[model samples]
Target: MHITFEKLLYREDYQIKLDHIVMNEENGNRLALYFRGHTDEVMVLIGDYSCNYFELSFEADCVLLRSSDLHELDDGVEFNTIPLVLYKDSALLTFATAWMGLKRDTSRDWTHYAIRAFEQDFHVLSPRPPVFTDLGHKMSDFTVRHSFNLPTES
Candidate 1:
């Protein structure tokens, strides 16, 4: 089956109001992105629940913005605030304003899923679809279980 990034991460108005990001690499690799309500009262989560690898990058414009006038459009308004987008056949997900990217693992032979933001890139090798959830007025009730254990000597 073929899936587009926009379709995979679709919302009613096609808007993603990012709240925070959660990453873990214990039993397995997992990257969870949380979104807060802006136009509606629903919190959404888009995550690579089980992934092999991931990466991140930060751009200067995202970090060294001394003034809003740098990229202001008019009346102190800015375009591409979050600047989240998909590239490389929807395998690369990017958040330009944040300057980050996520993409699929190229070295792996298995199927892959990826996301990127500006220059920050993250890649995940997994056949499963991303974990998506929506809860209305229950933002505090969401949970993702991740645990860590030391490797034992052979």
Candidate 2:
């Protein structure tokens, strides 16, 4: 699976093209699904992420999925999709809080609370550094291990 950003404009609009979408069953059958979209609403891609980023932290770990990983999957199979925000390390705290908010049903207060939390924790954790030259190789290895069991559509 490949997700290509054809173009992103300043009007908060963009187009994404997906290719090589294939789903393979255990028996070797394969299926393909593909489409393109442009939207002003970020929620279409972000899901519950429409709310402030700070409020995103309380959500459970399962709520987040890495954007890069999604692009590596065989395309045609239907799987759960979530906001790509989880790919940003800076958003980890927000996601953790969102996880909690889901349980307490107090997500309404998440935005304000998350802002305060960010201020408090920002100094504690150093900013993330850029990946090393071999990052791609390491990521490929990790993806193979993690997604090996996922059904392929080829």
lDDT of each candidate versus the true structure: 0.33, 0.25
- Candidate whose TM-score is highest: 1
Residue 150 displacement in candidate 2 (angstroms): 48
Q: Looking at candidate 1, what is the lDDT of residue 127?
A: 30
* Weakest 10 consecutive residues of candidate 2 by summed lDDT: 114-123
> Each prediction's TM-score against the native?
0.30, 0.16
Model 1: lowest-lDDT 10 consecutive positions: 57-66
Per-residue lDDT tens digits for candidate 1, residues 11-97, read 334333344455545515465554433322232233222211222222211111112322332212222323232222321122321
Model 2's lDDT to the true fold?
0.25
Residue-level lDDT of model 2, residues 1-154, one tens digit each, is 1222211112123322221233435423323222232342342232222221111112111232334433543323232221111122234334445555533544232221101111111111112221111111111111223565889799
